[model samples]
Target: MADEHRNEHAAPHHITPLTTYIFVFVARAAGTLLTWFASTVDLGWMNTPIALVIATTKAALVILTWVVVIGSFVWLGVLFVLTFADYLTRFWAIY
Candidate 1:
């Protein structure tokens, strides 16, 4: 009777498959390698955008796998808006 009572109070067990873990790890590694490779080449104006895209992809993977807070995207959106605003306000394109 005591065993049955203890069992009733026990938390449920969850098992994540090894394959899923392996896949995420491999993908993260590939992303890192690609970022390094991108740095070695000279694409002039395209470099910054390429790096940002790769970094955002890696951040998405990490957020999806670990972070539970959905509200964090609000900050990210704010940052993007401010960055673009600053970018647009620059007058360095003067003739």
Candidate 2:
């Protein structure tokens, strides 16, 4: 009875495989479309920033929909570490 109770309280991995496939397909499609649209515009210096923002948004949506909130948090942590590395390198270059 105790085991059953514990199992019931566990985080449910209820997302079906087909749901994951759909999410990946949708994200890829949206990302590609955004890239194509952005290319047609003359944002110039803002192009890279716009593309990165769009890509990150698509990635986050896919991650949240398919892998859930926990996976999104883990990805955010990785992004933070990479950002910190960039900051450290910039600071060290002053020497």
Candidate 3:
């Protein structure tokens, strides 16, 4: 009876296949290389946007692979708010 109860309350184990891990690893490595390459190229006004997109993509991959989806979204929401707040304040010196 105790064993049965323990099993019932235990969280299910999710086993990520080796191929999934390998795929993520390769993707992250590619992202790293892209970032390095991006730094060397001067794209004028487009540089920051391009780098941000690549970085965000890399971050999303890691979050999706290792974090619970809902939790990651919540965290991302908080970060977005904080970043927006900082951006909004950046122009304060001009005022």
Candidate 4:
């Protein structure tokens, strides 16, 4: 029974809108490369914003790709909200 179920589900269940996935991968890869490039530059104030943007983009891609809980859209929404809140709070002095 377990083997039967496995066989049924193992047939390459791909997500739709393949373009979106491609874009996500490209953005994440670009962000990673930018982060690496930024590390070698001595821009002082500019570094924080660059790093934050890269980190936020990478985090978003990860959440979208791997953390989609089954029947738990609310949780995903909350995670997104929290992630955005963190991103916003990082670059500025928030009271």
lDDT by candidate, in order shown: 0.83, 0.81, 0.88, 0.80
- Candidate 1 vs candidate 4: the TM-score winner is 1
Error of 2 at 67 (Å): 2.0
Tell me the deviation in Å of residue 53 in model 4: 1.6
Model 4 ranges off by over 4 Å: 1-15, 62-95
Candidate 4 per-residue C-alpha lDDT over 11-37 given as tens digits, one digit per residue, 9 for 90 to 100: 676665878778888988888889999
Separately for all candidates shown, the number of backbone clashes (residues 3 or more apart, or on different chains) is 0, 0, 0, 0
Q: Which digits, one per residue and each the tens of the lDDT, describe model 2 over residues 1-95? A: 65655766667667467867887788789798989999999997999999999888887776766665876688888999999888867867566
- Measured on C-alpha atoms, candidate 3 has an lDDT of 0.88
On the 0 to 100 scale, the lDDT of residue 54 in model 1 is 90
lDDT of 3 by residue, 2-95 (tens): 5655767678889888998899999989998999999999999989999999998988887888788897789889999999999977878776
Off by over 4 Å in 1: 1-15, 71-95
- lDDT of candidate 1? 0.83
Q: Alpha carbon lDDT of residue 61, candidate 3?
A: 86
TM-score: model 1 vs. ground truth: 0.57
Question: Model 1, range 18-37, lDDT digits (tens) per residue?
Answer: 88678778888999899899
TM-score of each: 0.57, 0.55, 0.74, 0.46
Top-scoring candidate (TM-score): 3
The local lDDT score (0 to 100) that residue 49 gets in candidate 1 is 97
The TM-score between candidate 4 and the true structure equals 0.46
